[model samples]
Target: MFRHIWIRLKFQNPDKRRPFYEEETRRSIIRKEEEQQWRKKKARRQSETVYDDHEADAGQNDGFTPTEGGPDPLICDVAYYARRVGLDMEEFKVQTEDGFLIDLWHIYDPAEYTPLPPGDRTPLGPSTIPTSPSSPPGPDPETKKKPKYPVLMIHGLLQSAGAYCTNDDASLAFYLCKSGYDVWLGNNRAGFNPQHTLLSYSDPRMWAWNIRQMGVLDLPALAARVLTATGAPKLGLVAHSQGTTQTLVALAKEQRPDLGERISVFCALAPAAYAGPLIGKMYFKFMRLISPAAFRVFFGIHAFIPLMMTMHSLLPGGLYGALGYRVFSFLFGWTDDRWDRGLRDRMFQFSPVYVSAESMRWWLGRECFAKQKCILQTKEEWREEDNQDKVEEEKRSSPDASPAEPESGAGEIDKSESHNHKASTAWYDHRVPPFALWVAGADLLVDGKRLLRRFASGREPHVRVVHQKVIDEYEHLDVIWAVDVVEQVGREVKEVLWATCEGREGWRIPVGCEEVGVWDGKSEGVVGGGKEKEGEGNGSGESEVEEVGRARVRPRSRFGGWFRG
Candidate 1:
C-alpha cells in the first residue's frame, strides 16, 4: 500500500507536514517512475500510433445537434436523453413499479436559441467567439473594456462541455469565446441542460439533483439568466467537473456579500474540493444508498426500450471505449479529487452520452445546499475552532474571507497533528480549503486557493499567480477541452481577463488558430478534433502513462443486457 503509506509518511511526526508529505512522496515517486517509462514507450509505439482510428470518426455527426429553443428536459421523452445515451452504454434498469432502476438522470437540451449567425460579428452575446486578445492595444484606441462579465463555462461531474471544447481542434469554450470572453457554454443542471424553470418533470424535486444542485440550483439559474441578458454584475465563473462542485457550493454559500463581488474573475480549472474517502466519504455513502430518494421509488421494473436500443447497437467501438474507461474510472476516479491525465485520452472527444448518471449522482451529496440555484450561504466567517469568538451573525453577507476568518478564536485546528496535516495538504501551502491554491498545473476543476481565499483575503484586493507551472498531463476535464489549454492553459486565465478588462497596453492576445496557418498561434490549445499531425508526433516528450492501475467494471454493458429483469 504505497510501501505502507510510504512507511507512515516516512515515520511521521516531526511537523510541517513531514516535508510536505515528504515532497508529495517524492512527487509521487517521480510521477510513478515517469509513468513507468511512459508505459514502456507507449507499449512500443502501440504499433505506430494509429491516431485513435482517425480520431474515432470525428464525433460521428458532430454528435447530437437538435436544439431549437431553450430548456427541453424531456417533452414526452423520446430523444430519451439523446437516444439511449448516444448509443452503446448498456446497464439499463428503469423499474419503478417497485422493482428499482430508474436512476438515469442526465440533462441539458437547450440547443435552439439561435440568433446571431451572419458571416460573423464581434463583442459578446452567445455562441462565443474570439481568439486574439492576449496582448492587444489598450485604454481606448479600440476599446479593450469589453470584458466586464460575460463568461459562463461551467463543467464537472460525469462532465460534458462537449469534451473540452473540441473544434478547429481542442476547444475550452471555443477558445474562451474567441478570446474576448463573453463566452457562455454552460451546460449544467444535468450535464446538458434538462430544462427546468421551477424544477419539473413532475418535480420529485427535479429528480432531487446533486453536485449541490449544480452550484446551488443549476448555477444560479444559469447566472440569473446570464445577469438578465448581460446587464452584468456577476457572471464570470469558469469551472469544470462538478463544475468545481457548484463553484465551491456557490462561493461558500452566497446569498449576497455583493454576490461574491459579482465574480468578475474566477477561473478555477481543476479545483476539486477535497474531503476524500474516495471523492469524500465513499461518495456520500454510495449516493446515500443506491443513488438517491430510494432509487426513485423503484424506477422501471426491468423495462425494455427496444431492448435498450439493441444493446446500444451491438457495441464494438473499442468495446465502447473500454466500457467508458470503466465508468470513467468507477465514477470520476476518486471522484476527481484531482490529477487528471487527459481522462482516458479525452473520452474520444465526447458525445458518447454527455453526462447523466443522474448527473453523476449530483456530486454525491444529493440535495439541500439551501435548495440550490445559487446565492449559496453567505454570512461568512470560518474557522470555528471549537467556537469562541461567538460570531454567528450570518444574515447573508460574506466573501472577503468573512471578517478575516472569524467564527474561531485560536483559529481552528486544535491538534491531531494539526488535523491530519490540514488533511493532506496541497492548496499550495496554506493547506487547502477555499480558492484552491489559485489553480495550479492546469486541468479544469478548481480550488484556486479556495476562490482566492473567498475573494482575496486581507480585506480583499488580492492578486496571486505565484510560481505557476504546467509541464503537461492536464486533467479535470483537460481545462476546457485540452488541445493545449487555450494557449498554454490558463496564463492567469488570460491574465485575469487582462486584469479584469483594462490592463497591459490595450489588452491584445489574438493570432487565432495558432497564427500563421494555425497549429496554434494561440487558438487556445487543449486539442481534440483529431490531433496528431504536427511532425506526426507521438508522446516523445518523456512519454508517461502507467496510471497506477485499475480498470475493472466490465462484467456487462458494451452490449450486455442490463436494465435487467
Candidate 2:
C-alpha cells in the first residue's frame, strides 16, 4: 500500500517532491562539491593553460557524427527498428545523463495498437471513419471532407512518437486512422528526431529547454502538419506522463488560443503533474542545485537505454532467462508498482523507456510545479515587491516555514499569492483546468475527487463532468495498455461521443434528444439532471457497471500488480 500510495504521490505532487525532508539540502551539497571541483580544475588548468588547450580541444571534438554511423562519439547509442507492427521505419533510443543513447526496437501492426475484445464496431481515426458520420459507416457516398482534426500523439519524457511503432501491429496512428481518424505522431524537442540532423550535445544549444518551449513549438508544429494534410480544424491530443505536462504548459502558454479550440479533446495516460513521490520529490528538489549539465555528468556513468527490458523479450528462452527476468522486473516498475511478470514480457516486445534528465527537471520544476503554484510565471503573481517582509514575518512566526523562493524567470519572490502561509502553488498539484473530460482511475495525475468536484461545481454549462465510477479498474496508463480496461472505458467514450455528435449548427447535446441523439442512455438533456431515472442520466457514476462487467480476462494488464484503493 505504501508503494502504491508512493507512486500516486509522485503524480499528485507539483512542486518539489519533498514530503517531509528538508528538501534541497542534497542538491546544495552536490552543488558545493561540483563548484569546488570546478574551481580546483580551473586553477590547475590556468597553471598549465598552454598544454590544457590542446587536450581540451582534442577531447571535445573527438566524437563522430551520427550520420557517419560506425560509432557515435558524444553518446553511446543503440539503433534498432520498432518491434511492433502498423508502423514505418520508426526507431528510437533511450538516453541517459551518462551520455548513452541505447537504440530500441518496436513492432508495428494493427493488432498491437487496437484495444482487445474487438469491440467498438466503429473505429475512431480516418480508416474507420464513415463516409458521412451522420450517414452509415461504409464507402463514401459523397466526396470526403476527411477529418480536419487528426489525432496528435505526444510522447512522454525521453520518448518519441516512434514509441508506438510496434512490429506486425499497426502503430497507434494506423489504428486510429483505421478507426477512421487521421493520426499524427511526433517527437518533442528532447527526443529522437531525424529532423534533428545537425545538433550535437557537445554544443550548448543542442539540448537546453524548459517545458515552456514544448507547447510553444513542438505540439503546434505537429498539429500544423496534420491539419494541413487532413484539412482538420481541430485534432485530438493524447499524451502520457511528462508528455502530458508539456501539453498542458503548451496549451496554457498563451500560444494559439485557436489551437486550444482546435483540440477535439485532451487524453492522458499515466499522466503526471506533481513531484511528491519520495524518490521523485527528492529528485526535483535535488535538481535545483544539480544543473542539467551536472545530471549529464552523472548520467555518463549509466547506460542511457532500457535495454534490459528489450533483451529479456528478444531472448526470452533458456540460458539467459534469469537475467532477462530480472531486467524485466525493474523496467515494469518504471510506470506502475509491482514486477508484473507478464508486463515485463510486453516491455521486452515493445519500445524501451527513454528518459531525459533535463526534460524531467524542466517538468518537475518549470512546467507544472513552480516554486509556488503558478505553473507559468503568470504576471498576475509577479511584479509585486512587498513579499520579502511578508516572508520574513511569516518565517519568524512559524519557524518551520521556508522563506519564499522565485522560479526560473519569475523575478523576486512576490507575495501576491505567495503568502508563506500557503505552501507555494508550485508545490501543490495542478487543479484540472476548467473544461476537460477526465477519465478517473485512469490515473491522469489529478486527484479524482478534486476533478469530480471541479467539473461538478455547476459552472461550465456545455461541459459535462462524466466520471467512471469503478467497482474494479482505472489505473493510470491502463487507458493505453490494459486491453480489458480500455474495453471498459471505450464503451463509455463511444457512447458519449455518439450521443454528443455535433449538429448542423456546431453544437453537441446529450443523446436521445434530436440535437443530441447518440447518448448511451446515460445522458439526460439538462445538465446534472440527476432527477432522471437512476440508469438514465450520464456520468453520474452509472453505466460503468454495464461496461466493466462485460470485460474478459479481467486481467489488469500484461503485468499483474493490482491497486485496491
Candidate 3:
C-alpha cells in the first residue's frame, strides 16, 4: 500500500497540484447545466408527448446535450450518465435459473430507438423466454433498417453493469452503441439491488452460490435475454477480469459448454484464468489460510462485507470514491495511472456492489481457485504439463542426441501420462466460440500471458484464437478505464467482433468496421512476438506516461515475429 502511494506521489505533476479541485469546480458547473436541460426535456416529454414511435425516433437526438466535463459527483445513476452522453439506457430485471434477479442495461442512441415503457420494465421470470412478435410492432421493415447486432458485456468482480457506463463517451457500452452495435451490460446475481423470487435477503440460500453458479446460470440467463431481445441467433460476448473467468469456466466442456454455441465471438479483456503474483499478497494469503467454517464466520454466509455497501450509501460520492480507491489499491495493487483521473470518482460508484461471501471464498479460500492457481487444473497437474513441455522442447533442440533407455515402471508412467493428458488437456469442446484476448501485460492480478500460451500451444485444440494482443503498459482495469482504451482495446474489439461475426449478412455493420474482412482463421498469432524491449516498465509501480511510447507498439511486419496455427 505504501509502495502504491509512493508511486502516485512520485509521478505527480508539480504544476497540477490542484487538479482534482479544479476538476470538481468545472464538473459542478457542467452538471448543474446538464441537470437543468434534462429536467426541461423531461417536463416537455411528460406534458406534451404521447407514445409515438416515429416521433420519438425522429426527436431522439434533440434533447441530448453532451456534458463538457466528467460526470456529476452526486449522481450515481447509469441512465443519467447515459443521457449526458447523448445515449439512453433501459434497465431490465433478468432472473437466473436459481431465481436471482440481476440487472441488464441496454444502451442505445435516443435518436435511433424508442425507450420501453415503465409498465413493460418488470422482472423477467426464470421460465420466460422472449420471442419476437409475429407481426411488425413499430416502423415498417421496408422503411426502417434492421437493428444493430447485439453485444453482451459482463463486468468484473464486485461491480455492477454501471461500470461500463462511467467513462462517458469513451465507455465501452456507449462506444459500441454509437458504433452501431446494440450493447447490453450484464450484472451478476446479487448486484446493487439483490433480489430473489422465493427467498429474502436473510435467506442463506439466496447467497449460496460461487463462480460456478455465475458461469452456468447468471451468464447464460443474461445472454439468452440479449439474444431474445435482439432476435439474434448469437451475440458477441465481451468480458473483463472475473467476467472473463466465469466465461472461461462456462465454455469449458465439463460445465455449460452449450452456452458457447449461442456466442459469435468471446472478447476477453484482462482475462483472468491463471492467478498472478498478487494472489500471494498478505490479505489473499490470509483468506487462503482460513478454514471454510472460519471464512463463513468472518465474512458471513450472506453478503461479503455488507458494510461496504452500507458505506456506499452513507458516504458522500467523492469521499466514498476516494476511500474506495485507497482500500482497493491496498487490496489489489491497482493504480489509476492510465485511467481518466477526472472520472475516477464516477468509476468507483459502480463497483463494490453486493457479492456473496461464498463467491469470495471460491476466489480466495483455502480449497478453491486460490489454491489451484489455474481455474481448471491443480498446481501439480499444470506443473507436470510444463515439465513435459520442457522435455519436448529439449528434444526438438537436440535431434542428434541419443534417446534415454526406458527405466523400470516406464509402462506405468506412460499410462499415467495418458490419463493425466486426457483429464487436463482441453477445457472447451468444438461448441466453443472463437476467442479474441486483450491481455494486460503488466497486470499483476491475473496471468493472462500464461492463458494465451495455453491456447497458442495445442492444449485447447477446439479453441480458435482469432485475435490476440498484449498491452505492456496496462494493469487489470486499464482495458476499460484507461483514457486511450478506445484506441488500444475498443477499436480492436470492434473489428474483431465484426470479423468473427458468423451471420453478418442480416445485421447492420458497426461503424469503423465496414471494411473489416471476415477473419480467415489465419490471423491467430501473437502481437510483437518477441522478448520485451529492455528498460520497459512491466507494470511494477512505473509511471504510465513514461512508457507511453512503448505501449502497444507492434512490429512493422511479421517477418521476424512468431505466428500460431
Candidate 4:
C-alpha cells in the first residue's frame, strides 16, 4: 500500500522530483484556492440564513463565538501562556534511555517563592500538608509551608505540553501550580519540539518509534528526571488520553512497579486504552479502522497528520479555525465542542504534531484491535505468559510434586516472585499508590469509562479509588480544552491531589464535589461519596455505574462489552 502511494506521490506527480521551492509553491496555490472556495461557501450560508436580533444575541453568548484580540494561537503555547498569566515558567530537556530528547516545562506559582529547590518545602494552606494516613505527621500549623510533591502533566496524542496551558491559568498545569503544587508539563517524542541527541528530523529512524517507546523509555526517564530535578521521593502523574495509555502500559503491563512507587498518584483525564468501537460517527470509525500501512501512506512516515500544519501554513488565519474545527471534530468526535472558539486559531497552531509511522501503527494496527491490547504484545501472548507463571506456581505448591520440579520451580518462583512483587505494587491491583480517573461521558474516540472500570472494579484489592467521575457532556478533548473545564475538571483534580497530600486511604472522593450544572447528563446528584445508584444506563450519553466502589466488571473482551452488563 505504501509502495503504491509512494509511486503515485513520487512518480505520477512530477513535482515530487522537482526542487522543493517549486513543489511547495504549487501546493500552496492549490490550498489557497480550496480555502477561497470554503470561505465563499461559508459567506453564502450566512447570507442565506435569515437571522434576527434574539438569535444574534444568543450566538454572541454561545461558547463557540470568537473573542476579539485573542493571542496568536501559534505563538501562545504552554510556555507562552504560563508566562502571560503571571506564573513562572522554566524549560528543561529530558533524554530518554533511547536517544529521543523530550521537552519538560515546569510551572511555578509566583506567590510561593522559596530557595529550597523545587520539591523540598512543605505544602501551603492548612489542608495541603503531607500527612500519612497511617501516621499523622506533617508540618507545624504556624509555618504554612509550600507543597513539596511535584506533579508531572502529560498531554495526549498530536498535542504538546501546550494542551494543558492553552486555557491560560485555568489550565490544569497552571491550576495545580497556583494551588501549591510543583507542576511539570511533559512533551513526548515527535511533539512540536521533536529534538533528539543523535538523530536528525529527516531520518526516518528518529520517527521509527511509537507509544511503546513512550511506555518503556520516555515516561520512566521523564518521571525519574522529574524526581531527581525536584529532589522529591515521589511525584504525582497527571496524564490525558494517550498519555494515560503509555503510563498504564509502563506501570501495569510492563511491570515497572518501581515507577508506580515513585509516582504518588496517577490522574488520567480522558484515559485511552481498550478503546471501544467508534460509535455514532462513521468518519471517526473509518479513520480508526484504516490499516496502519494505509494510514502511513495517507499521513506519510515523518508526521502523523502533517496536513494540519500544512493547512495552518497554507490557509489564511481567518479560515483555519473553521477548517480545524470540522476536521478535528470528524477525527476525534466532539459531542460538545468545548474548546473556546476564541482560541481556535492557537489550537491549530500546535496540533497534529509529528508522530512516527511506527507509532501510528501501534495505535491503529491489528495488534491493538485483534488482540484487544494496545501495546507491543498481544493480549493472548500476555495471557499465555501469565498462565505459564501460574501453572509453574501450582506445581511448586502441590505436595506430590517431584523434588527436581520444586528445585527448578524454586528458582523460577524466586524470579516470578520478584515480578509478582512488582506486579503487586501496580495501580490496578491497588498495592501502593492512589489514582484518580476522570472520564468524558460522550467521548467517541476512546472508552474512558472502560479504562476507569478496569482499575476501579473487579480487580484485586490494593489502594483506594481516589476519585472516579464522568462529566456527561464532555468529549475526548473537552477534558483539556473545555470552556468550563477549570471549574468542573480542575476542581476535582486539585481536590484529589489534596486528598493524597493529606494522607487519606482507599476510595476517598474529594469533599464538597457537587455535580456541576454544566454536566447536564445523568450525574445530577452524585458527589464525594462511595454510594452510587445502580441501574442500566440508557443511551443518554451517561454511564451506568456509580461514582465509587465496585471493581465488579471484568476486563472487556475484544469486540463487545464496552459497558458492563
Off by over 4 Å in 4: 1-76, 110-148, 279-300, 305-307, 310-319, 335-337, 370-432, 502-544, 547-565
Ranking by TM-score: 3, 4, 2, 1
**Number of the top-ranking candidate, with TM-score as the measure:** 3
On lDDT, who's better, 3 or 4? 3
User: What C-alpha lDDT does candidate 1 achieve relative to the native structure?
Assistant: 0.36
Clash count in backbone of candidate 1 = 105
Best lDDT among the predictions, by candidate number: 3
RMSD of 4: 15.2
Candidates arranged by lDDT, highest first: 3, 4, 2, 1
What tens-digit string does per-residue lDDT give for candidate 2 at 312-412?
34563342434433543343223322112223233333233333344445543332343322233331232121243345335566867775676765643
Off by over 4 Å in 1: 2-6, 9-154, 158-180, 183-187, 190-295, 298-332, 335-565
Write model 3 residue lDDT over 172-202, tens digit each, in one string: 8888888888899999998888899899999
Q: What is the lDDT of residue 94 in candidate 1?
A: 18
Global lDDT of each candidate: 0.36, 0.37, 0.76, 0.58
Q: What is the lDDT of residue 503 in candidate 1?
A: 34
State in Å the error of residue 105, model 3: 0.7
**lDDT: the better of candidates 1 and 4:** 4
Cα-based lDDT at residue 506, candidate 1? 30
